[model samples]
Structures are given as C-alpha cells and as structure tokens.
Target chain A: MTSDILAEAMDYIDDDLISQAYSYSRGRPKFSKPLAVAALVAVVVVAAVAAIKYSDAFITAPDSGDSSTTAEYFGGFMPDKISDGELEYEGTPFTEKEISTFVEKNKYDLIGAIAAEYGDFESVYKISTSGYSHVNLGETNTLKYDYVDLPVCRDDEIIAKITLFRSDGGLSYTISVRGKAFDKYNSIYQGNLSAELAFFYYGFEELIITPTNHIYRVHGTEETLEIDRSMNYYEKYATEYNTFSYNELTDEKKYITVKPLPEEQINDGSAYTSSDIEEETAEAPETSTVRTVNIYVEDLMSEEIASVEWGSGYDLMLDRPFRVCTEAQKSEMLRFIENMKPTEAAEPVQYYGGGYIVRLVYADGTRASVVLMGGDQVYFETSEGESPIYVDTNGNASALAEYIVSLI
Target chain B: MDDTSIIKLYWERDENAVRETAAKYGKLCIKLSENILNNKSDAEECVNDSYLTVWNRIPDERPDYFSAFLCRIVKNLSLKRLEHNTAQKRNPEMLVSLDELQECLPSDNLPEKSFDARLLGKSISDFLRKQKEVDRCIFIRRYWYSDSVKAIAEDLGVKEDRISVTLFRMRKKLKIHLEKEGFCL
Candidate 1:
C-alpha cells in the first residue's frame, strides 16, 4: 500500500495525530477568484507566446544536409503553406483538424506543451507518449509501450529528445533539453501526463525543470529565484525571508517588505526585538548568582534577515522555541565555553556575511561580550583580547560564538 | 482552554471557539505541516486552511478528542499540498518513510486482493492496541504525522539511536501481526 493509503487508514484511530494536524484554527480565508483568473490568463499568454516563438525556429526546416527528413516531418505535421521553411507566428494557427491529424499520423498521445527561454533565444517543446493505454488496476494485464528515444532537430543539431516508458502504474515522460554550452543541457521528468512543466533559470548559471505550480522571476546572479508577487501567501513569505538585492550590481527596488509583527504576536519568544532585550535585561535579578548566557547570530549580508538567539532557557531564533537544552546540549555548551581561548591580535580577513555575538552575565553583575567574524578564516574577539583560531573539519570553534551555532 | 470547553463554544455557535483553538493548537498544526511540506510558508497556509476546516466541521461534529480531529484535518491538507507540489518528483523524506514500510506491506502487484480501507484501519488499530503505549505513539508519529526520527526522539526526551531501535523492532512486530491476521506478506 502507498504511504498515503496507510496515513489515511491511521487517521481513523489516532487522536493525537488528528489534533496535531488541526492545531491551527484561523478558519479558511477566501481567495480572490478574479485575481487568480487574471494570473492564470497571464501565465497562459506568456507560455503561448514563448512556445510559438521558439517552436517556429525548430519546426521550419531550412535547405541543408539531411533536409528531406526534416521536410517530411514538417510536411506531415504542418499545413502546406507553412512547410516552405518560413517561421512566423503571424501565420495561420493550427486548426483542430490539423492537430488531430498530426496526432493520429504520429501514433502518439499529445500530453502537454512547455516553453523555455535562454538568453536571447526561446525553445518550445511538446510532450507525447507512444504505445500508452488505459488499463484497470484490479485485473491482471500486460503492460504496453516499447521504450523509444525520439530526437527533435534544429538546423541539423539535435536540440531536444523525448524518452517514454511506463512505471508506477502510469506513463512517464523524460524530456531532455540539449545545447552546446556549459550548464545548458537539462532533463525534466513528468510521472503523470497532465502535470504542468516548469523551467527555472538559476542566476544565468543553470536551468532547472520541474513540475511545479509556483511561479518564479529571475534575479540576475542570485541563486534563488524570486517568487512572483501575485501568487499565494507562501510565495510572498519566501520572497520576504530568503531573497536579498546587491545595491552595487543593480539599483535597489525593494520587492519584499516585511511589516513588523504586533506586540502580542512578537512575545512568542522565537524572536526578540532590541527593545524586548533591553526590557528583559532591566528586569534581571540584581543579586542572584545565576549566569545568563545570550547568543545572537546574524547573516551579515542581509540585516533584515531574522537573527537567531539563544538565552534564558529558550532558543528564540528557531521556528519553534526550544524550551530547554538537553543534558547533552548543555554539556556541549559548557565544553565549548571552556575551550575558548583569548586571541593575541585581531587578523585582517574578508567577511562575506555571517557572524555571532555572545553576551555573558557574571554573578557579580558584570557583563562581557564576544564577537566572532565568519568566513574562511574565523576571528574571535573578546573584551580583553582577539585571535585567529583554526576551525577543524568537525567545525569545532575556539570561541563560544561558533560553538553556539553548531549546537543550533 | 480545555477541549470540552472548545466543543461547548462550537455548540453554542460562539466565534471565540476559533480564536481559542488557534491560541492553543496553532503551533502544533504548523509543525505538522512543516514536517510534511518542509517550507515555512506552505506550512503556515496548510495550518490556516486546517483551522478553517475545523471551523466548518466542528458545529456538526463535536469530536470526543478535539486534538485528534484537528490534527487529522491538518495532516490530510498538508499531504494534499505535498502531492500537488511533488507531482513530478516524490518528496525525498516521504519516499524514505514509504520505502521503509515497503518490506512489511503487501506488494502493489497483488491486484486481485482489494482490501477495504476501514477494515485495514481497524486491523491496524487492533495491532496498536496490543503494543506498548510509547511504541504505538512513536509509530503513529512517524508513519501518520510523517515526523522525522530526530523529532520523535527529541519530543520523547530519548536518544535518537534508542528511538531508531524501537521503531525497527515495532515494524517487525507489525509485520508478524499482519501476517497472523491472514494478509499475505
């Protein structure tokens, strides 16, 4: 049985699992149907334009070596008027009769269509399966479909290839996009025929293809693609938390702005503002011998990105508050604190982004803080000293700052 | 608020029931969604949707165990979201859990053996009833909620290796139990 079937079965008996699943009770919010429809229309138009532009170049055969095979394929698929090797979107659209005739003649099931852009050129690919048949699962039946690789050519160069097979009780399609460049060739698979095919460009370095509903917009040289703002709440959250812009590379236009959370919502202890920290310290025990350790880690590149904090029996930075450290974690932290050594001098090194600050409160109402710079060469600075220490392969740090990060 | 009180609020048609439920169980729903979806934003949406599902269902169905009722909705919703996201490729975490259970489960090729889902669920519940309380909880958490072994261990305040060993033994017992119940291995 599939995991889903088992999970469904378990749902009947498990109260805790059921409760955990339904713990969030905000009630379903209604979506704007008109906005959703508008977005869908925009996506369809973009896909259609891209498909027409790219497929036109590949479909029309020019006079060259082995041009007859290309001509025959085009003649069989395209109307006589368009088979003369002129690629134009303004030409007459494919009629229903032509589409049906093309499918029947090719002896394949037309599954779906996809379009992708690379630099100045665009490519459109068609998905189809040969020798596929619908069969009931309850009866013993022989599987159909012989595995075959069909090549699609452009100017005598094989630009795309399609391989079809059967697996997991359904037809599978593997579409490979090929080109003569580093990181140009990519393969995307569709286990089911009706799924949408998405192409994501990775910072001009690589192209990723998947069957996903999420829409992405390319930000030059950034590994992560920015989610389209017009999508769902999740897309908006991703854009706000995971993306950052380089001011030197491009003029900064703030695409994602995070509104400050309300005071009550902010008190969850997962994140603390500067004011909250100050207030907490103000209420600390004056004469108590209890040593309070607070550690704050930040992504130096993006100041807006939420920083992680560990202090006062809670890890406020984690998505969920780690109420208390386990015995092992406590020991590890102690070991890290003891191993920390004062540095002789601060070394000059390049800092790309991440760093940590550790605040230690002594029993005598004295406080000391340490700063650790993160990079290839890690530098540790304390109130009395600073030094460069070797970080081992196991990521053992010479200071509490690095050690706390490892624990988290 | 206690579960019975929440049910009472729903019975009284009080909107405060939704708010009270959110305050109490919202984090748990989000955690369950996060375990399955592995994306914070998707988890948040799934939790919100699950909350809405509870709001719509509770008036007609005052569940004996409110937590279970809520969790079931959220888990189902999260799984649906995951299915939509991974239509082309299976989620790696989900695939791993499924693969582990493959050894104990009847082969998918047994086309003639169409078993009723309710009967199978009853059989599983019977089997769990015979198991130790902790073992049953761990099994449900892993398979039903799709929680990571590390998470189960941490939640139970046990060592990760101990949890792994317990799960390994439990799966063996489940296989034997199912076999004894006349299902072909």
Candidate 2:
C-alpha cells in the first residue's frame, strides 16, 4: 500500500471538513479578554454617537448634583401632584387621580425610580413585549419588538411615544422625552441604566429580563403575554451583511474546467465525468439571454419558483434534468442559495465545463440560471451581453452539490 | 479582524496581513506542525514558512477558509521537513499514523504516471464526507494532522480504545469504498 501517497493526499481534503474537525474539537473561536474588552468599548462608543445623533433631546443629571431634581421631576412619593398627565396603560387611559387612587389602594411606590435612578425620562415611554421562540432553534430569539406604541400624555399633549427594540442578551429600556419634558430633562450629562426596571406604581407587571426567552411571567396568575420580537429581523439584518457581487474575479482568472457528459453515456449511470479531465481552450457559447435587475441569489423567493431543475455539464448521465420533486427539497435548495456569500467571479469558462447547473423558473415567467463549481463557488450564468457573476458558497454549495448528485 | 478583512489586507499588499494571520492562526498552525515534526523549533519554522507562503499566495488566491488554508500549508511543510530529517532515521511517531492508513491504500505498484495524488485525495475527501461527522473528524485528526490516538480521544472526549476501533472500522470501509470507486487493484 502507498501510505506515503495517501498521507500527502490529505492535503486536498475539503476546506469545510477541515474547519469542522477543528471547530468541533476546539468549539467556537473565542475573543481574548482584551479583544472582548476592546469590542465592548467600541460598541459603547458607537451607541453613544448614535444616541447623540439620532435623539432630539438628551436627558441629563442635575447641574446642582442633587438627585432630588430628578426625583422631583418624576414626582417622587407624592402621588397627588406627580402630573396632570394621563398614563396610558394598554390602550386604557388613566388620569393622575386614578393612578394615585390605585397607588394608594395597592400601597405601591408612587415615585417613578426609573426617572430617579436613570436621571431622566425621555417623553417617549418605550416598552418591548416578549421575544418569540425561534422555529428552528426552539429558543426565544431576544428580538425586542412587534412593537406596540403607547403615548405618555401631559394634559392633552402626547409627550412620549414608546418604541420597542430587540435585545438578545437581555432586556433594555430607553426613555426619550419630548416637548416640554424634553426642555426640562434634556442636558449634556449622561447616565447609564443597564437593567430593566419594575414599576410598582401602577397596573404594569414586573418586566423580567433574561438571557433566555422566559421573559415576563405573571407574579401569581398563570397568564402569559408572548410577543414576536423577531418579526422582519431576517428581512432587515440578514441581507445587510450577506449582500455580495461577482465583480472581484478578474478576466484572466481561470476556473476548473467542467465538460459536458460524453454523448454515448448521456442519461446512463456509468461514466460520471471526472474533474481531472484536461482543460480545453475553447470558450463557452453565449447562451445566456436573460436580463435581471439588481437581484441577488438571496433575493430569490422560494414560493415564487414554479420549477427547480438541476443537472451537470460534466455528467452526461445527469443531462436528463432532475426536477426538484419535493417542496422541502425546493426550500432547502433556495436556502442554500440564500446562504452563499458574494465572491469574485472566475473566468466565464465555467459555463462550458463540468459545472453543476441549477435552473429556476419563477411564476412571473422570469428564469434564472446558476452554476455550482467543484471549488465550492457559484456563478450566475449570464446572457450574451451580461457579465458572469460568482459567489462564495462557504461550503454551502457542496451540500447543494451533494443533493444534486444524489438525484443521479 | 474578520477573515474577509484580513484577505482584503493581503490583496491590498499590506504587511500587517502577515501579522494578523500570525496572531489569529499562529497557534493552530504550530500545533498541527508539532503533531507531525515532533520538534518544537522545526515546527515553529514550518509555521513561519507557511505564513510567508500565505502572504505570497493570497491576493492571487483568497481562500474562504483561511485557517484551513494556513493549516494545510503548515502540515505539508512539516511533512517535507520530516522527510528530510528522517532520511537516515525513521520517525516512528509519524510512521505509526501512516502505517494505520497503509491497510486501506490501493496497490502502490501502479505506474507513477497513472497516479494522480489530487484525484485520490478528492476521492478520500468525498468518501469522508459520507461518514458521520465524529468519525470523519477522527480520521482527519489521525491521518491529516498526524495526531496521536490518545490526543484524538482527548480532543473528542472519547476513550482511546473507541477511537482505535472506529479507525479500524473506517479503514475497512474506506478500502471497500475505494475498490468500488475503481481506485484499488
């Protein structure tokens, strides 16, 4: 046995497999303590900048260094004189008298410590409902909204509106004051309130902030209010970091040549085209005629696809197109495409070779064609006038390629 | 910095790319080399050489898996060093791992011109993909990284005997797979 040859052959092993072995053994890579600290500092700085830029009014500590100023502003302990404003609770408006009566009856703390401790209450009263359970992970995704807007009113004027934002690690409260309160509380001095506060002053339940999804269980009753915080999260964030283009590959770059299956062996099980075949100098014909807008692979809607077909230019046997038979398979195929990272294009020669081809026919009569190569790269097979585009599959293409090969 | 950012640095011809690569993957590359060469200085040298090769290769080849790409280089270089150092003296440490694979390899008598190391490697890779992740990891840890059975067991949190038995079964299965793929005589 040629053990030496076998030993050297280890070099060509798939990159993702190598990564999996390393990662499985080592677990996820962790930031060093210093790196973690640096990252935290950077996040804090960015948040501060964003707060200053976006917020109309900045809440500040009193110039006299007295916490009582904030205490007085929130009407500490004095339920009768807090404000003439009506505190809107879950669509039911309650006047200051009603709040004071409730506080008196319940023996609750009338002073809003959220204002005292945090040094300012922005006119906006923000409250996030509970996050939703992830369909795949079965864990609560700490996304902060499906936001319900509630206005804190002073007399007839709506002073603050609550805006909900999602948090994965924990619950957060950001109070922004507007109008008259904005003039009263807005200042240069800043204070940080990292924890979620439970107000005993009114009908509101204790806000539970947890690292997990088990948020806000009622004190005595078995009642639970679940909120879908992850609403539109994918539509908002996933596309931001994942968008890519094939403009990186230069004209001179060479791709692994894939050849059409031999004519005699087309549709037969034997003679799978080996990628080891020599490269031919011949260029692929300009077969692409479809023109698309600035659409990306991730932009393709699985529901809209009327048909999914896959074949290989290299394997003549698979030239008889294998249609995606199951909805699950179709979804899986689209999901894989969505996960592909934008990468540089290789030479347009891939359109001519042993590359795997997937054709998608949409219900609107739009057709899209993509080529998956042996190197775990994918490219949009363009038309006669369009440039070929490539994307990095990050090994997702291999899974897709395996699925396509399985059909054969 | 992320791998893409580091790769961009290389493409931009920034020298800091080497520093970043060393900072991020230096330990992994060294450990992989040490597993094979068994000499600390030689392993370090191999890792450094691998970094330089990465510096030169990138911009031309922006690897998606930067760690794997670097580790492969370090492993190859260490193997070359091992071959040179063991010309007169066989290193039993590495030989143990290779000998285990000897049972599954196809006939070595095929003419040199007929052997495509890459095709064989691709075949092995394709076969490995079909196995369970743990079994695949064990096979790669032992053969690709030249890790000791005890080390593999420790890394995987399994018994050394379990690793041994799994490797044995995997080799037999691989032989059958290769024979079916027409790689064996």
DockQ of each: 0.12, 0.20
Residue ranges of candidate 1 with Cα displaced over 4 Å: A14-408, B87-91
lDDT per residue, candidate 1, A1-408, as tens digits?
766565556666646433432331121011111333333323322232222221211111111112122111111111111122221121122232432333333222111111121111233223221111111111121111222223333322334444333223322233333222212221122231232322222211112222333433211222223222243322212211111112111211211112223323333432333342335345534433222222222221122112222322111111112212222223433544454433333532222223344443332334323344431123223332332221211011213234434433
Top candidate, metric TM-score: 2
Q: Name the lDDT value of residue A271 in candidate 1.
A: 31
**Candidate 1, A335: how far from true, in Å?**
37
Instruction: Encode model 2's per-residue lDDT on B2-31: one tens digit a residue.
Output: 788899999999999999988877777887
TM-score of each: 0.35, 0.36
Worst 10 residues of 2 chain A by lDDT: A312-321
Local error of candidate 1 at B85, Å?
1.4
lDDT of 1 by residue, B81-125 (tens): 987885544345655665676566677776534655566677777
| lDDT by residue (tens digit), candidate 2, A173-257 | 2233322222221110011122221111111121222222223322222132222444332332221111111111111121111
Candidate 1 displacement at residue A230 in angstroms: 45
How many residue pairs clash in each candidate at the backbone level? 16, 17
